[model samples]
Target: MTRPKTTPLPPTIVVVFGITGDLARRKLLPAIFDLYLKGLLPSQFRLVGFMRRDLSKLEFQTLIQDSLTKYHRGASSTSLKKFLKLIVLEQGQFDDPAAYERLGEQLKSLDNSLGVCTNKLFYLAVPPALYPTIFPLIKKSHLAKACESARAGTGWTRFLVEKPFGRDLGTARSLERQLKNIFTEDQIFRIDHYLAKETLQNIITFRLANPLFANIWNRGHIVRVEVRLLEQEGIVGRGSFYDEVGALRDVGQNHLLQMLALVAMETPATLTAASIRAARERVLKGLKLAHSDFKESVQRGQYEGYLNESGVAPYSTTETYFKINATVTTGPLRGVPFTLESGKGLPVKKTEIKIYFKNLKLIPVEVESGEVGNVLTFTIQPNEGVALSLLAKEPGLDYLVTEKNLEFAYATGWPDRLIPSDYERLLFDALMGDSTLFPTRGEIIASWQFITPILNQLNKLPLTRYRRGDLPSVS
Candidate 1:
């Protein structure tokens, strides 16, 4: 558990849009607090929370305090107080030009106090619809540009956008064009929090570092690859948003597909961001539906009583669950069936990738009824870890074989240290200008290209109904 040594980050200012939203309260604020506690943040850092809510400075501070207590427990009262002092809240509507003007002033005021032009990192915690409204405001106010006149143009500005980039390929491209107008591709960080997870990142290290598994990571040695992301809770108050995006666009296009790329991608020339991203882009560009017919390659499902949910259309055919059988048309995994499944209101909440290896031919020993081949699983949540299932001979007079699992849990393996949350890792990376964990524009477009056709045929596909706590049966 040796850690990499790193230089201290530069003085910075982080402005979070829609800071009053659920994502900011539950994840962003807490993660920033954790970084402060760990002394990983720069000493001259400032946090600006932009929202439409009309609250006093004290009230906003209280709100952040409550949020931190609830989402990120175990912080010392003294440390919490000190962190709150670094926060500044700006109340304004997204569409108001005056609000953007005031935001620019606030940023300038902070810089004046610090006597330096600090780097700016804007985190769009709001929905995708607000992006069009916000991006232009940022540009109009000169908030997207570096302060070249001040401090010899040492400062930089970057935007960290959340997932569900767009509804489909067409909309995604449109949004990309808008983003390009405001910021360069290098300055935009399209975040897929799943990619920041330790276990998912380990997939690359585990495969390449060990010759035992790396040699057999091709279609010749693997039977199939399954990526499952199931949740026990329904849309919960996001019915309006969920109804429009559905399961495939919400999770399948980004998280699930990214996982598949990591599993199917070839060894990178180096571990740098450019090398790894290039490898991932190659896999995504070659992905396609496994079958010619949509029905055979995709399955859609909705939880029973979904129509009764508030904000949901009476006859909405939106799917809360989807299972797609995709194939990598090129590379070592060409023609390999990669089943990607995700759903809400399932019996259990689990996220993992299972790689089923091809069965080995037995010649020297006679097997007495046992499952062959190995199943390598990388659990991404609930309990983050990796497990390998293998057949073992039972100790007895009679010959018997049983499936045994060799497992490693992060909690148990790293008992002495706290594992950073996904948002924490991602936010830190953005501040450090590390795009290694973030998906590139090419990756996003490639994923959308593969998903747009499936989305177009949703009308012809049948949506199966399942109980709230049951798994949907898919052929």
Candidate 2:
């Protein structure tokens, strides 16, 4: 595929709400610096770090330098110095009104220095609990509005929100209402970093562009779909947060469902954001648990040492692992079963989608009963690649069948290509006003509608216990 032309970006100011947070240090700041290195950011760009920490300008710069060095290695000293020049720190508490006023003044100063109204991208990198506190303050400070008095409203404002959008449907709806009151639908960019991964995006392109796969992507040709997101690391420092959230809400509702939608949704009419999101939303709306009884379709498990983890309750029923069987009731995927599983502290860290194809019974060649059919896999992480497993005759006189893997890895297949990190691609897309990689409000709501019911019945279902590295029993 030919590379698309890069468009010039407008002069903009990015205001990161929680600059001291882990996400900012690890992903957001690193991504922004990468964009700077690539000259994707405009010459008049500025990154305003909004946090309560009162540090000197030099101190803030040093901290950011350390972060870049740790998270983004091999950055040249010259580039680091140039990037640091764009950093501006705003010391303020989330609930402090005076702090917001000062931030407004700082933004005005930035605009004045540019001699024109600049676009603003506010990144709420903080936790969801602080969203309510910050949302009203932004509106009260008139930060969401364009500068009509100073300039003729040439600038646009966008909000980038991270996910686990909400705990459940009610909370998600409430959050939507809060955001709607403050910002318009188009102004809101709901970040689902998974959607921005090269491999994930390729799923749509691979299906649509390749006639070989597209022709057979349906219930008739496929058997069952499996979307698995497994992690090898435990909740080490995040026990408090993890204990409350568990695996289902943390990934099942967002990542797993999103991947399943991409795998099952019909070919979109066009490749635009509207068409793609509409296709996903339709699949999400039609999804339901395969069994009415939650226990029959859902399995929950807690890691063996979860109780000993810091901030976790001794008798906590929170599930660190979950496996769900869901079915699509509409479209061409009707009656197809999708196994969505996610867990922490597993033996391996992997995120992939496996599509099983029906085996051909008409063939005269003898095949073992244990031999499965062709399996097409989209590996999202650990290694970004796609592989198709097929039964082939073994290299011997006897006609024995063995599974052969035809793999395409991004690293080996495109050695010189610089694949952007999930956060990097997402941040760049947000700046370019491209919402194709982000989730829509309707998609979020539809996902929650399907997941909320299962979550509600989770308490009644007994939680199984398994060791950290062991694969939990599904039955």
Candidate 3:
């Protein structure tokens, strides 16, 4: 890909919440450093760290170094040094009004001394429990007011919140209300990090731009849509939270559904961020989780438990895998059943969405023909790229056709440079105040509304089961 020659964004100050955590050290800082090294960071920018940690500036930079340097081998020392000097640390705790005030003063002092504008971006890298406490704290601290007073005209102040939007629709609604007090609908950036991936972003573009797909991307021509999010390993030590949320809340509600949304959304007249979100919002709002409604359309399962993996566990019933046969009620594909499949302990590592194209194969019939039709599969992980399988000549006698697969690998034909991690890319966007990759309020609300029914069903029925290392399927 050619380097994009574009003007830099307005100078901005980035405040990272939970700055000392794994997310900040591993992803946020590296992404920002990459942008800085690439000359993409604005000339007058400040990347501030906020959390309970009492690390000095040098110590904070060291924290980022220990994790990010190994992952971002391409980064230069000079760029990291420049970024570190611009970075600062401030201590703040949830529900503390004075801490927010002091943090605000730091932003003010930096703006005045550095001659930087007051555009501030707050990243809530903290847990959801901290959100209901911190949002009101920011509102009370007058950081929102500082955004108003900045010379840059309605000084840009936006907040980026991590996912697991809420436990259910009611809780999600409450969380939104908590944020509504301090930030406008547009001021909040809820991240489904998967949405920020290059290939994930390329989904609709790959399909809509090509006439071969746009013409037949409907129930009339397509038989089914299979969307999968697979991981080769188990939950590891993150079971404290994963046990409660399970696969549905962790990957199902957001990422898998997001892919389905992009595949199922119609061709909007235009593809602006707002327009595209509007299309997604329409699909989310129409979601009704009646067990009877989708008796055939939806399926859920959990992987073999940690305590019961033969000798892996003595005996346990906790599920680490799940599958859902979701039906979207929005866009041109409304009422269309999209198979949402994912597993925690799969046989191998693979994440792809297979689009079942109808009848392009000239179907196997008479003779020894082995035609199985055509399918366009978009793989987002492991071996990243697109693959298409279709019937082809067997190179033997006439009518001796056989099934053949063709793949276009994105990783193969790219530049030698490494692509930033999904978390890195998203954090960089937040720092630069580009909210296009983040999910909006409408999208979050719609997601919660769609997920509420599934949660209710899970609570009512707990035997959802699947074997370890088993592939995910609707059956």
Candidate 4:
């Protein structure tokens, strides 16, 4: 008999752990509401928020509406108002036992009302300290257990935890083991939202699909790689937290590192994620851990605390930004230092990775569009998008390179660009029990393998100070 094509289910319910926190307000809710407005949400979908906020259901919707209007980019007012109706709020303590039971009931009612066993997606957006107490609580609450039961007709449940997965290698490993022991590795989905950006995802696809580009994606043709992240604003509310996390963990270890892996990883045997990650993981391990490479390729710093932020401790020694340059330790490109910059305060509101071909100075000039050299930049945030910036020949006959850009943002109706929130996508992946995107125990261990040096240096030594609003890091 021919196997039937099993239909996939749309999202039914999302339970956010820190529903009232900054992440929930700034990114999660806005992205979800945007997903809803776009007609992507299930007809029976609902949002079940977990927080200590003392507010009624209507009040929570009001809170989310305010954020959707104020912070959501490319969102329509009418669409947002309609989305408010689909959201259902639940007030409960994150760590309390009774709270877990209350949450279970809330999910049950919504799932039953939907006429099918609905999905239970947990977004752990609370502080890192709260995860230990909350994660197991989520599991113990019978929600996580339900997901693992695999009984026919039972609803799926998934948990999405935020980063700072752990402070060091040991913690990261232990945490992964713990989570996996409870939920299959396939059941957990990690969200390094940068992966969802079309440009980064497109890096391999665009290169391979086009013979023009794929033919020379090797040492024979390429030169240096530059990863830059700039933030135009100082740490407003997350200074202390960011200070503890630092740039290495803030962006480098996760976003930048992930991007570097995607760009530099050997062409997988195939497009299958396992094939790609197998190649990527090998590249990550090839990084040089020696002190010399450490100094030249890695850097750490804290921006001078602003006067009125109240976030910086009077004697705080935490660093808010960092820059790193290092080469991969294995493969054809070994010894080529990959430079990365991450900072708390800066003049430009951008995060991008620019791959310079041949040399930093001589970029490929675009014959048309009045451009010179080809530069690919993946832009994340302010608006989620990607821009292909190339240097073109000067308008006159001179050989000077001019710059031209072809950008794709979510608002323009790019299909993949309209994917669900990083949280939503990860949660959905988790409920479906897929761990392809989430970092594995080995990957987590590997992340800290190279990352420990920077962390140790931060704890053992004084940080090099940087001016607020300066370029995050440098050569």
Alpha-carbon lDDT, every model: 0.90, 0.88, 0.72, 0.68
Clashing residue pairs found in predicted model 3: 303-320, 303-321, 307-313, 308-313
What CA root-mean-square deviation does each model show from the true structure?
Answer: 2.2, 2.0, 3.4, 5.0
**By TM-score, highest first, what's the ranking?**
2, 1, 3, 4
Models sorted by lDDT, best on top: 1, 2, 3, 4
Count: clashes, candidate 1: 0
Lowest-scoring 10 consecutive residues by lDDT in candidate 2? 146-155
* Superior by lDDT: candidate 1 or candidate 3: 1
lDDT of 2 at 185: 86
The predicted structure with the larger lDDT, 1 or 4, is 1
Q: In candidate 2, what are the lDDT values of residues 1-475, reduced to their tens digit?
A: 2225466766899999999888999999999998888888877899999998888998888989999999995788899998998888999899999999999999999999999789899999999988989999999999999655425434889899989788899999999999999998888999888898888899987887899888888889888999999999998799899888988989899999899888888888888888888999999999998887778899999889889999998899999999999999876678999999999989999999998888877564455646478889999999999999878889989867778899999999999987898888888888777788888899999999999988888988888899889999868
TM-score for all models, in order of appearance: 0.96, 0.96, 0.90, 0.81
Report residue 347 deviation for candidate 3 (angstroms): 0.9
Best candidate, TM-score: 2
User: Residue 104 lDDT in model 2?
Assistant: 97
Model 1 worst lDDT window (10 residues): 363-372
Candidate 3 clash figure, as a count: 4
| Residue range 1-475, candidate 3, lDDT tens digits | 1124435666678898988887777777777777777776667888888889777767777877666677675767776666678887888666678888889889889988866555778888888888877877787777765454545543678778888888888888888888887777767788888887777777777778788877777777776678888887888777666666777788888998788777877776566677777777777677544246554545555665655333343443444666566676666666666777776877878888888766754455432343355778988887678888866666766766666678877677576756667876776666555566777777787887777776776544444555667775534
Residue 304, model 4, lDDT:
62
Supply the global lDDT for candidate 1.
0.90
Scored by Cα lDDT, where does model 3 land? 0.72
